[model samples]
Target: MGFFNMLLSLAAKGAVILFFLLLLAFLGYCLYIKRIHMKYDHIPGPPRHSFFLGHSPTFLQVMKEGKIIHDKFREWSEEYGPVYRTNVLHFVFICVTCPEATKEILMSPKYPKDKFLYKRLFNLFGQRFLGNGLVTAVDHDLWYKQRRIMDPAFSSLYLRGLMGTFNERAEKLMNKLSDIADSGTEAKMLHLVNCVTLDVIAKIAFGVDLDLLTNKSPFPEAIETCLKGMVFYIRDTLFEFNPKNRPFINEVKEACRLLRTTGARWIQDRKTAMQNGEDVPKDILTQIIKAASKEENMSKEDDEFMLDNFVTFFIAGQETTANQLGFCIMELARHPEILEKAKKEVDDVIGMKQEITYDDLGQLIYLSQVLKEVLRIYPTAPGTSRDVVEDMVIDGIHVPGGCTAFFSSYVTGRMEKFFKDPLTFDPERFHPDAPKPYYCYFPFALGPRSCLGQNFAQMEAKVVMAKLIQRFDFTLLPGETFEVLDTGTLRPKSGVLCSVRHRKYSK
Candidate 1:
């Protein structure tokens, strides 16, 4: 009885000390947030939805409403001006639509990626999704090193060699569409495009044949679940508490695990091949593995880091291009005259050629412009964010340090000041004689941190679109809405449903 009483007394004393320590920390945090709030007092934003939640409630509502977050940002920008602040809890994020501000922020790598967002990708849904890959790496020096090593994989020569693979995968899509067109059935172009892109990336990047065109690969649904979960995780702070979201949360976790596990197996096979002196194809896996092996601080963890790149390249290389192609088809179907013009260009350049050559790509300038216009309006990965570690003045506004600045391509693309009749699908905006959009359009982003696979994606898009336009005439299915869906990447809400018939002139 005496010993038990002594133990209880000691536990009480420890609890009292712990409570006081927490109290001190809470007080310190309050003071810090107060200082941050005062610094941005001049900037205008929506009134706090709650004293405790700030604007987070409204932000969450925007996300949950199946509305693109950037659309909401654009709406708010009209009321609050080009530069407006948003608060989520105590955190202040500045949304910038000003071209000058965007140019300054994106042109340099000094503004590191905001950790609050990027760090979530490092381990989301209690599973490592992107990990510390090139896209999610927060450390500037580390990302730079990885970028340098991976540059060769995306170099002009390397990409040119992959043209054959691009044509091959795109041909599979053409065959599938031909079958659909023969059946007189309306098809979801986005779904078929997704299949082609998935098959292309798997083959070219990893030397793995997914055959998504003929076979229903599990990767697409897995990728969709993972992406949806990530977007959910980003917006919903109380997501875990919702009983309804539990099953979905579990599915996302499993999807992430499946992706990482598949990546690990592929990486191991490559490593084993290298060890056995077997001939391995020159692909992204080979390139990054060489890079990983050369790291000065090589450890098991460093080797595992290559898996990050594997997952990153697979999703990044495929998803954005597929979304872009789907939107391009949707727009062309909507505007038949523009489609006819594009078809003329394709017919003139391709001339009954089944295979698209590198030289053939440049001559398809009109088609290229249409693709560019598509990107301008429907940038799949809409915007990017930066961590302003140091206080900086953007357009005469003093934005303090330790804040996040969001630059949106979607918001900037739609502004009437930048693009006249911004909502209209006009490919002529990218006509050769017209002036270039200065510092305002970046579908694949801009600067030193721009997407490495820009050339690869555009090249692949051109080949697929060239073959598509060369062979088929598309019509959007009736009652199909063209609403943009924001599942991390912006895709057509109705999946670009369309019926197709073989072109009369096609050989």
Candidate 2:
């Protein structure tokens, strides 16, 4: 009886201690929020979050079940205000949602790019070849120089020339889809996109032909493995204390090593083909070689960096485009009216033509708007970040140096003040007279550091959408809601399944 009484006493003490700790944590959070609010009390945001977790766990839970974080963020904004702070794993994330604040901070040189997560990829992995490529590197003169080196390849004339590549591959994609459509088979929709995007980038970036539509080879699988490779590092963020994480870091290194070896081989073969009087293709590799020859310092670095560029572009380029295209399709499939409107626009412009030429695409204003609208709804990336080099003030809020600044086109695109009927899929919102979405709806980002492949990605989407719509009218099957999966970019967590019927043009 005495021992039992002792045990009960211990349990009661443990419970009381836990309750006290919880109370103290709550008090700390209230104090922190109160302090932040007192100074910037006029600012806006959600209610006070947990001491360390902030609203991340709640938002992450919603996203895990296929809901968008933007919806919750906007709700908080309406209640709290546009500019507010939320903590994540002990880090307070200050969000600038007001359009004017977004412009002031993102465009300001004082607010710099943060290397928190992205740097681990390059500094830790085999990305040493980037030698200051746009995505991973800092915004410096050298970054600009390297960016300029690759710009001409994406220029109007160059992109127009690349249309032939897009056509051949897109037809292959249509034929593959038709086979599945005829047989009533539905594989992961994302898989088909990955294949086409790989084929597209292989041709455009490396000047190689990978008939991914037909090729069931391991090489493409290996290439895709390299692209899906980031999942391990991301997983590390969740289970940081796990000792197994080291193996993952090593695994990435080994993967990069293998990718680098294959890339070097491809480059050698391409160079040899060009040297032996063999007719070489006009593609991204050739463009890079030409640029390197003209530039003063692009070639002075270690050959591994150059070859790393090959692997980086080949893998990263394909994945980024694939993610964007997948999200676009997801949005279109969710909103059939928007899809039909786009189809109608395409039909009116090209008139049921089987082939979509560069010139034919030029007249697709509404089609272009549909693509833009999809991008706005689901940006290819969640947001871009910058580390403040010096103290900066956005709307009177002092952002101290060394603090990270994240500019979310994802969040900005959905802001109520920036977009009317923000959730609606109205492509007309992109028309000239429609309120301009300069800083508001930037999916490809803006300013000097914008996506170099914007034109290429647009052309790819336009061509693919036109061909698919011209051949097939798409509708969401029985029961499927368009949900955003915010991973590398906003993609459909579950593959978007649709019932596609051949276009008969009723009108």
Candidate 3:
């Protein structure tokens, strides 16, 4: 009895000691985070919401409200000047909207991606999500190598070949919309657009056809869930500990597993075909595998990293373009005069044409301007962050090394200093005679790390829009809220609810 009591006493004492030690370590961590914030004291920004919580709550609120983060950013920039600071917990992010600073930061390879932010993307919920993919690769050398290998897949020749896939998938969507148009049923343009883009990427990139339009595929829903999961994992501090979030976290993990499994199956099939000495389709996966072989010091984990890119390109190639198309339709439905001009341009250029060729896309000039204008107002992936490796002066503000600098295409695109009547959706702003918005207008981003698929996305968008305009007249459904939802990537909150009908042609 005596010995048992003594053992219990010792265990109780150990627990107390360990708890106090943990308390001290947390205090130390808080102090270290505080010192980092002190370095940016010279910079102007909104006052932190709390000494302990910082600006994280405000950020969460903005996200939950379904308004674009850039809206709040614009307000802050007007009050705090072009360059300002914001904090989430211990990390301080300085947002620079000055055109010169934007150019210098984006154009230079010296400023690599912010390691802290990109690293989060590397592992979501302790699973490797975007591991060293071109978008998330922090090491500049590795990124350059990866970029070089993937360049051919996105080259002009390759993209021109993809025009057929784009048009074919787009035709499938128009057929689906035609059914809805005939029935006078409301369609969520974003959902259908997402289906078409997903099908296009699957067929073109992987040589696999996902008939998402015919059958309701779970892939789109899984990707959407994963995107929402990213926001939850990134923001919610007690994500793992909270029982309420466990189901959601599990769903995200399963989604990741599903994607990786699909990628593995696709990869294995390609390898089998190659080993059998049989003819195999030349696709993005084939190109990626070949690229990996050519890379010096290629590790056995090369295939795993390729899966990283599979998920990256799959999500990247589809979501942003779909969201952009949805927003373009919404804006067109709201503005009838602008819609008629675009419709007329499409009719004059395309006129019920069966194939939208590369030359035909070029001739749809007004439609091109309209697409550019849509991105100007609503860039899907709004901003990019860079790590300041060296001390630099940005717009007369001396920012220290180890600080994160953020540049928002959305915020910059909407600024009065960059665009006249910034809130207005004027396609005329992109007229050939009009001066370009310079550094302010980057829908696909700028510099060496700029979206390699910019031309590809633009082509895809033009084809989809041309067809939609050629076939149907769309009207926004009543009680639909036209707002942007940022679940990692910006998309329409209501999924762009609209009713479509076949256009009435004069005899």
Candidate 4:
């Protein structure tokens, strides 16, 4: 009986020891997290994580709610200083909003966007075609090299040459709309406009006119596949956020698989034409070909890589430009005065009877200001990132190595301190020699990685807007707002629906 009691006592003691050990383990983790949290404790931000999970669950929750994580960051930015930290997954994410910090990040030769996941996703799209094209596809040194090679293609003179593509597509789109409006009188503007933009991008970027606006289902198969293919990627990325002994990294051997398979076929076809010494129409793709041909290092193996750029250009230029048009047009439909101002400027310059020319559109300064304002409010490309190359101090916060930082034009656009009324769609804010908005309102971004197609894009927008407003006066069909689906570009949450009427401008 005494021996049995001794065994029971021993077991009780062991149980107590086990409980204390578990408690200590938990306490240590708490202290580690607490120490890190306190490092930024004095800095204004949202509530720190209550546990080690930090902002991971919040990010997934935000995604589940179909909202952008940046929206939450914008709210936090109002209270926090220009630079603040938010724990995103295991990351101590730093967001910089001030102009100085923005310039430091964007213009720095060292900082590049952290595109680890995007690189893999892009590779799935086609690694070869996008191997070195701008925007997350290239490393910093390659980006600089690619930028230098591509700059001449978008020179003022080159941009002038591309204006006809916009004018041509806009005319076709207008006529198509006229036919539609004659029959139905009103239609969803999003898809039709997107089709036109894609066609235009295809033409300007590569000189291959798919005529997507007129074609019934040109990019249908590829677009569908590309869209669906991204799901596997998003799923795989979220899976990596778990810290509990997750193993394996996928080296997507086909960085340009789809792109190469499909894109290379086109590149091969184009090369054959060039091999026969045929005149490929002068487009951005042709320009790239010219550069490659001139490049001593370029080889047949590089064709897939070059074609990746064309695909990237197609996705990048077309997608963003299309969304911006929808957003701006929606804003115009909502605010009659803004639309009228745009119309007046167009009419004043081109005068209702004249065909809008690229050169003529440039003379319409007030119209340009309106577009600038639109870009500022609903920029095509919203937020961007920069990974700190070395230890750096941003906004007095000393960031350590491997820290990724960011600035959102989307967020900056809404800051009360940035603009008098940041949310309002007032074009006059961009009058020539306009009072500058603290250099923080970067829509196309600035320096180094600024949108390569800005000049071409602006030309396209000017022509499209001029022709569009002249032809149709749209009313937002009562009780409709263009919802937000902010991503690489901003878009209508539920599509910009409107009642369209053909405008007859009286002389």
Top candidate on lDDT is: 1
TM-score of 3: 0.95
The sequence of per-residue lDDT tens digits that candidate 2 reaches over residues 164-253 is 888888889888888877877664556787889888888777877778777774555555444444533432345335676656556545
Model 4, 1-507: lDDT tens digits are 999999999999999999999999888877877776765545455765446656666665776677865678788888777888766434466788978878777886667667653465555433232454577554776666566667778898888777677888888888887887788666677776788888888777766667766677535345434433443343334554555413221223232355456566766777788889897888776777777777666665456457656667767777777777887778888888878877887777877653666679768887788777777877767777777657777777777756567778888887888888788788878887778877688888877778888877778877887888878888776767656864435677657777777898676
> Candidate 4 versus the native: TM-score?
0.84
- Which model is ahead, 1 or 2, in terms of TM-score? 1
**Span of ten consecutive residues with least summed lDDT in model 1:** 295-304
**Each model's total of backbone clashes:** 0, 9, 0, 10
lDDT of all predictions, in order shown?
0.87, 0.68, 0.86, 0.70
Model 1 backbone overlap count: 0
- Model 2 lDDT vs. the true structure? 0.68
Off by over 4 Å in 1: 1-28, 241-244, 291-296
Runs of candidate 2 exceeding 4 Å displacement: 1-80, 86-93, 108-111, 123-131, 217-241, 244-255, 275-277, 297-302, 505-507
lDDT of 4 at 377: 73
Pitting candidate 1 against candidate 2, the one with the higher lDDT is: 1
Scored against the true structure, residue 490 in model 1 reaches a CA lDDT of: 94
